[model samples]
Target: MSTAVRRRRALTGRGAGALLAGLLLVIAANLLAAPILLYVALLLFLLVLFAVLVVHIPRRSGPVTRRISTDLLTVGEESQVAVRFDLRALRIPHGIWHDQLPPAVSGDATGEFPTDNGTSIRYAITGVRRGVWAVGPLTLHTIDPFGFAQRQQEFGETRTVTVVPEVVPLAPLSSNIGAAGGTAHTSSTRLGQGSDNLSPRFYVSGDSMRRIHWRATAHRGDLMVRQEEEESSPDALVVLDRTARRWERQGPTADVAFETAVSACASVALHLVQEGYGVDVLDSAGTVLGRLRGHEDDRDGLLVALAMVRPQGEARDIVSLFDGTPPGPLVLITGHLDEEDAALLRHGGASAPILLMTDPLPGAAEAAARLGWSSAPLRDDIGAAWEDALPARMATGGGHVQR
Candidate 1:
């Protein structure tokens, strides 16, 4: 867009060839005493001057309307766009065009087409990384057929592309949670007379005629009454560490480790949601970024939230993340496994925390080993790893309470 750049592009490839021809003309004229050589040099100089003018002249491209298949996408999925340019009654010859693309996107952003036959430009966009990115306004560099000059023009407006994290079914925790014919983390209590789909409930007094279970009353010969509501603890609580420092290997830039951490969290969160659990994604400061309440909640909403999460570069208070929650299974996802970070898992109010990391954590592992807590590597292939690790750790019996 700068004047300097426009001036540079104006130097067409054919202009150089023409200049060469002019030089040869002058040489022959000098040797043969030909007067045409002077005219040839003049012509070459005039042509070069014309190129300069062509670059400096303001050129506006035909009005264009932009169309993208979608503005929202999953990390591994691809989206595409088509731009329609009105070329009717237009004087544009052949032009090279380029659309601005985000760094996380993979594919060619440039294209070339003659305006004589068509008015559309199309490109496919795939996101290899997760995050919020800016996708475009278009820029054009057009070349004249004579090669004497070029024209530069830019049009359209920048658009945002939100790329959410990839989600896969999480490895099931080795417990009765999966056996409940639903996702509740623990074995359901006795089904109460009320609330739909009872997961084992407790019997209470003051039972109404409609509230009492007739089948249970007949079996026990007493008024079998229960609250239809299920206990909340049997549900899983997933904690994510968004501290800026923990995910960073360098300054604010997060490496693949952080990405892995996010993917791990997303996979686990999606799994829990499917199995019927609620997930609250938070930062190190306990700042609530988003939540997904099992199958009852919007699945894409959670992924969209996860897609926008970025490393905060602060030390997240991992240990106390579940300080006041009704106890159940606690799953924490982070990059490196460290003692302080692991402490959140060790001391969390739950019976024992299930610590999952982007990769293997020796310090955390040793801590988990000694404390009898369930801990394991969280990887790109998280479902398989979780499926493999959960049972062994549970069978070994996650350590006894220290508090």
Candidate 2:
């Protein structure tokens, strides 16, 4: 409101013809000694001055409120964006109010709104891209009774809408081999399937001896036991390569490769979270963007983070990303593979690490294969390389998405 008040300024535009005509008439009438013409010209001049004065004062308008169908929206989906004006009994007979909006929400009418009981206007807006955008600061276009002057006033605060990435269905990385009780499930599983579902608590004095987790006791140097939490999701770590290195043969931005890569990341995160998995999303820099599990809040946050992530540089630090990650199936997504990357994954402790390449590298896939990494190449039909990375049964029509 204060910003609007400070910005308010009087603009005398578009009524010059009549002002010129009145000035000419006054001079001509004075030369011709016509009192009636002279009187009319003087009256017209005075009226114009009065209108300008009226338009300049009280520059600030009333408060405005905006509402969207939902604050959380998906890319390519349409939502109604509406704004309401709290017109508190101002005698604005012929004025139009316009709200400034982003191009994504353009095409809505920003004209005169009703003032009798307050007015609201709505537009159907579809988010073209994923990211957060602000919508706000209402502007009022007020016209005087004579239609000769229009005054502008601004009101209201900024509102934000988050457009999250589209979550497409993707088959689990491995069906018969990993994560869930399967062939890939090792005997010495450090992270238990039960702990993901059950909450572990500090051991109390009366706890049963068998219930005490010796492993937790060894790790924590104190007795610990599992406690029941209504529901929890399994943990899954997704490593994304953000290095500006070559994914597709493109410039610095690498728009095409980045788009496909982001889609792949989003797909993986969404699939894991929806299917009762806590996903730790990390970039090449080992920056943990989101640790989203099946929880409602985690799911929402993961999608939004995926939508805005882009390649920062080459994701050369593989070992750094492994730090603090709970034992889980690892999915490494990268533009290309190197010897160092392959060596790191070989002994990384992930029984069968899944590798998704954004593009088909000449020898990178083979290098990873030699080290026993499941390699999947990027394809047009496949939204992400992970689709092809899965076993045949889980990759296509017969696969189960869980949720």
Candidate 3:
């Protein structure tokens, strides 16, 4: 119990005992039969009456119950935190209630209800920021009928809620090949043919029958075959820097950068997924966040996983992570960048497009220029940068074709 509550209990006990003692004295004085005894009895009776009238009086009190619908939510979104107060056998004329909200939720209104009888009250809270929020030990205070004493009750369980960042869209930018006065030609090392299928096209004059599409010939009126073409559309691999040092602060400075990275990755992944391109996301610790396998239903799971992403103690070295032969088009998002990191990416064998996203570093533009990479500064408008870095025509009907 709190010190204040213990003190109040002690005061109430003493006052009750004193009132009882005065009543007993008055009863004994009535039996004395002498005038002085009678006068003394009347005086003691008056004193007891005064004590009861001025000090001891019924106070308001009852049990309070609260229930939170969810312990996790997203920023800038409203989650229903149901608060229920149960009052029983307590005649509370009027009382004000204040719910202790976490610092992240910056607002004055939580839930306040006045009651004269045993009843239940409910209210909702809307969280507006990210991080863990605590819903607290409710406090209730009331003044006694005589106004000489006050009673307070505290109840409800402490809860924690985690709020994640929000996701937005990105803008469009020109491709490096297009800017270099060379028509962009889509080429891939993967063995494949016409857009998707990997089977070879049928023989023309000396064409081999093995290359013919028997299924297509049966469906179509004429003979049809697959074409042997190198995989043109390269996969997009997104890498997010989630090292402990990256998200060192809990305030707007570091937190905003972390959120921006998450938002950018999510937006780009979703956009690419919708555009019929395979997408893979990797965190700083070399953990694959998501690898969509031509399945759109898995998008929700990806988002939920991202929502729970927290900085870990694992130290991530960007240079070593992508050291050897690289995969497809790589997009690296980080809060810090160095010369060695730039060199590692440039020599990382990422022949496909390489996009670097990081906080505004001292030599960001210069490093990007050296590596022949298009740089996007981390800002409130990072979503725009993400969109701009993507290929111009990345839709279902259109394919990255060679000129």
TM-score of each: 0.74, 0.72, 0.58
> Which candidate leads in lDDT?
2
57-126: candidate 2 lDDT, tens digit per residue? 5444566787889677776678887887766644665676666655544335466667565667786767
Least well predicted 10-residue stretch by lDDT in candidate 1: 1-10
Which candidate's TM-score is highest? 1
Q: What TM value does model 3 have?
A: 0.58
lDDT of 2: 0.64
**Tens-digit lDDT track of model 1 for 1-403:** 1112233555667787788788888889899999988798878878787765655454454566777786667777888878776643345556787777766777676888555634688888888777787666667776655678776666766777788777776545445434442344443243442346542233566546566666776777766754456444244556677665566554434477777777777777677665565555665566665566544335666667777777675654555554455445567676666775454455344543666676555577766655556667766677655654463455656532211
- Tens-digit lDDT track of model 3 for 320-353: 5553545445677766666555544452554345
Runs of candidate 1 exceeding 4 Å displacement: 1-7, 20-32, 43-58, 87-89, 116-118, 181-234, 250-254, 294-298, 313-320, 339-344, 359-363, 391-393, 396-403
At residue 39, what lDDT does model 2 achieve? 81
TM-score of 1: 0.74
| TM-score ranking of the models | 1, 2, 3
